[model samples]
Structure formats: C-alpha cells, structure tokens
Target: MSVSQPYPQTYPQQGAPAPAPGYAPQPGYPPQGQMPGQGPGPMPGQMPGGQMPGQFQGQPPVQPPRTPTMAGAAERPNLLHALASESTKLWTTRSTLWLLICATLSMPVVDFAISSHYAGLDQVLRSQFTTDSSISALTALLLYVPLGVMVITTEYSSGMIRNIFTACPRRARVLTAKTLMLFVGTLVTTTLLSALSLFVSHAMLPGNFGEPVANSDVLTTAFRCGIYLTLATMFSYGLGAILKRSAPAILIMMAAIFVPFVVAVVTGAAPGSLGEKLMDYSLISGLLSQFNPQDAPATGPSATGILIYLAIAAAAAIGGAYALVLTRDT
Candidate 1:
C-alpha cells in the first residue's frame, strides 16, 4: 500500500479581506475610530448614557410616587379642617358623649330640687333664679373640665397624638383646633344646660317672684354663665396640653378652682384689700358674681371684665403649650 501525502495549509497575504459583517469585536477592543469609554452609537430615541430624553447619566430621573388625595388634600390643613377633625374626634369618643349627657341630665334635676325648695319659701330672693341657672357652671367644672382634659390626654395615652401630629404637621394648628373646638362645644353645651335649668327654675318659682326680673337680665346671665364655663374648660384643656396627662391636669385644675376660695374663706381676706381682690378674682367668686342682680351693680371688675381677664390667662396658657409643643419631642 502506498502512503498518502498530507495537504499543506496556506496563509493569507498582508492587507487581506476582513471578517464578515455583524461580527462582534473581541474583548478590550473598541470599534473603529472610537475612544475607550465610548460604545456603539446610542440607539434611536436613546441619549448618550443609554438614558431616555431628560434623564441623568448615572441614575434615571426619579419622580416622586403619586399618592391618592382626599378632598382638600393638596392644601395644607387650615383652621377649619383642624376644627372639623377635632370635632369628629371629640364627638366620636364615648367618654365625651357620656360626660356631656351627664352634664345635660344632671343639671335640670339639681336645679329643679333647688328651685322647688326656694319656690316653697314664703319669700324668694330675686337672685335665686340666676343662682339656680349658674349651678350648671359648677357642674361643668366637674364634668366638662375633665372632658377638656381628656381631649388631649386621651390622645397622649393611646399614642394617637403621634399620628395627629403626622397628619397635621403644624403643632400650633392642632392646638388651635383643640382650643376652638372646646370653646364652641363648651359654650354651646353650657348655655343650653343653663337655659334649661333657668326654665325649670322659672317653672318651679312662683309667677310673682319672676315678675321683677327683666327678660334681658336672665338672658345676659345665661350668656355670661356660658362664657365662664367655656373659659374654664379652655383653661383645663391648656393644662392637659401642658402636662400631657389626665389625672395631673384635672387635679391641677381642681386646685386652681378651689384653693383660692378655701384660702379666702379660711383667712377671711379683709374687704377691698389685695387679698380680697385676689379672692374676688378667684373662679368661684367670679362665677358667683355672675348671678348677681343686674340692677345691683358697681364692683371693681364686672363679670365681663373678669371674663376678659380669664380669657387672657387661658390664651397665655395655650400659647405656652404651643411653644412647648414646638420645642419638645412628641
């Protein structure tokens, strides 16, 4: 058998034809005439950095995620929205409803008893009607003041205030909302109860006894009683905001209400002295002064003046609370 000869391979000469089209370049190699960092020209509709139009290089332009908005959600919460929120919070709470119901139901029963006793007397004093109506203020001191305290304290206790602050980032708006709600709610509730008490008193008293008092006097007394109770409750609400606790706030409020009167009674503050004037300005004294007959007047500060003073003090306390809320942690 004869051995077959091996075929020899041939090499291409210099300047030979290139590889076929669509062939990938080797690693570490750039396309013809391109720099190290450069790649193939960006595809149609793409920018230099492989980004779409209006996009940055390293990261694509990020848009904030859209959120669903409620009515007025685009707007920062205003006083009216805060007021509506606070009203809903207050009315929805079981404790608030119970306290109001107690205030409403208890007032007429107490007034009727007192009025009947006085009406049976041979001669009833002219101030008795006003006094009977004014009893609701004290009742409010017990029921409504705590209601105000709970308004803030309940949120604190439940850890819900953090969410409230989150929803309404402006702490002052929250405080203002609470104050306005308490003011209006307390005023309306107290006025209605006072009027109801006054009506019951009028029914129990003899027709002749009410004849001397003018209708305006009774209306003025009722309105003033409402104002006082509203201020007192606002004061308590401020205390709650300051302290952030229910028991402590309510106790402090009770002390403010009773301590001055007790001291005045025990020391028998001399008439028209500094002590006497301070005692006169005590909440109890101011409240009693509201029941005085309209014709009998001429005192240092009239009921309205005293109310203004109380209002100033309440505003100051609330202002302090707002300051503290701003400076302190939640």
Candidate 2:
C-alpha cells in the first residue's frame, strides 16, 4: 500500500508563488536563456543607459591635480612671497637667533663699559669718548659676518637652494629678494642697537665727556653707524652668495674687512701713501671717520665720500651675486 504521503505536501508555503514554469532556481546560475554575462540591467539610482546620475557617459573627467602644466610667469613666485620665505628662514634658524642676539646686545654692553671706563679718566674729550663708543658698534661684526654668510650658505649646505631655484626659476629675482631682506633686516636691527648704545653710553658718562642722546649729532651718528653695519653685512651676504660656502665666504669677508689693518701695521703704510689712502676706504676707517671727523685725513675722502664708495662697492657685489645666480646652476 502506498505509504500515506506525509500530510499531502504543499510547496512554497501558503499564498507564496512558485518558480516560473520550465525555470528552476539554482544557487550559482542566472535565469535560463539569459546571456551568461548579462546582469539585471542597471542598478538602482543608475540611469537606464548604465550612466550614473550627473555623470556623462564618456571618458573619466580630467583630474587637475594629476594633470601636468608648465609653469608660466603667472605661476612663478613673486618678490613678496620670496621675501616672506627668506624672512621666515632667517628668523627661524637657531644660529640666526643667537647671532642676532649677540649682535644686538654687543653694542650696548660695550658702549656702557667704555663709557664707564672713560668716566674714571680725568681728561677725556667728548669727541674721543663718542668716537670710542661709536667704534664699539663694530664689535658686532664679529657676529654679523657669520650671520650674513650663513644666510646663504645654510641653504646651500642643506640642499634647500635646489628647491628654491626650482620654485622660482627667475634666479635673479630670488637673489634680489634675499638682498632686500638682508638689507632691511640688518638696517633696522643695527639702527635700533646703535640708538640704544648711544643712550646707554651717554647715561654712563659725565655731560662734558659724552653728548646727550637727544643731540642731533648723536642721532645722525647713530643712524650713520646703522648704515655702516647694514652695508657691511650686505657685503658679507654678497660674498656668501658668490662663494656658496660658509667657511670660505667668512674667511674672505674677514680678510676684506680687517686685512687693511693688518697691512697697515705690518708695512706701516705711510700717511698720504696709496696704501694709506686705500686703508681710509676700509670699513673700519670710514666708520671711525664718520664717528669723529677729526680722525679723517685732511686730503683723503671725507666720511661721506667713503660711505658713498662703500655703497657703490656693496651694489657691485650684490649685482655680481645676482648675475652669478643667473648663470650658475643651483
């Protein structure tokens, strides 16, 4: 006897539909007769033509970040950007900070000590005291020259000059920016230091031995001293750019600055001789003359003339640096 079919089977639960006739659902296969590679048309949220909404059915959109373009004039960095970059680099370095600190403080400290020394002297002329005090500002050069040289050499040593040149292909513009930055920075710092040193020196000396800080002569001399320091530092900077090595550049700068004194001492360049005339144009000589006109030779270049010469020399050095930057590879 046919065993009772277990409870007369009812497929696909009550009210649930069954698979279509002649089509059997299988685990890994699509519906019968449908192409093997065909999918169930476009997915939801996609357009009928298989395009996503808001996306055209064409090649992928251009990605600007990945696209390459040659740098044009408009793309090149401007002077202001270069100036700001140089300023940041200048102020951020620890060597720059320490060197500047020494340069800034040396003037006031040396001036005070000198003025105090003069205070004890019985016969100190005001000109002599002022002259000594003004000369004290030159002590800062011991730090300023290295500071200037490092400004360029540090970049070279660290291989940063390559990046800088790459960014601003107009190398002359970069050099111009550096020159302006160094000039302004050195000028402002040295001028303020000179003014402060004047006040400090005057405070430590008797009225007869030192001019008041408010004296027009004191103000003018302080400003001139600042100009001297600025120009001297710029000269060192130009040497740095040309040499591109800190040690050699510093050595050359020191020789240029102090060799005259050495020559004068060793050879005793007779007064009014050509050698002596050349020494008169040295940085220290012009500075001394500026501080005390009496120290200047009667027939030699005046302090103003010496400063003009210094300015001319500094301009030539900087111009040469800019030219070399254009011609040489970073």
State which candidate has the highest lDDT.
2
Using all chains and alpha carbons, the TM-scores for the candidates as numbered come to 0.72, 0.75
What lDDT tens digits, residue by residue, belong to model 2 across residues 223-323? 88888888888888888888899999889888877888677666766877767766766667777887776778676788778778878877887888888
Each model's number of backbone clashes? 0, 0
Where in model 1 is the C-alpha error above 4 Å? 1-78, 207-213, 272-275, 293-300
Residue 180 shift from truth in candidate 2, angstroms: 1.2
lDDT of 2 at 38: 74
Q: Candidate 1's residue-wise lDDT over 141-214, tens digit each?
A: 67878888888888988999999999888888888788878888889888777776776677677654445556
Cα lDDT for residue 294, candidate 1: 47
- Give the 10-residue window scoring lowest on summed lDDT in candidate 2: 206-215
| Model 1 steric clash pairs | none
lDDT of each: 0.77, 0.78
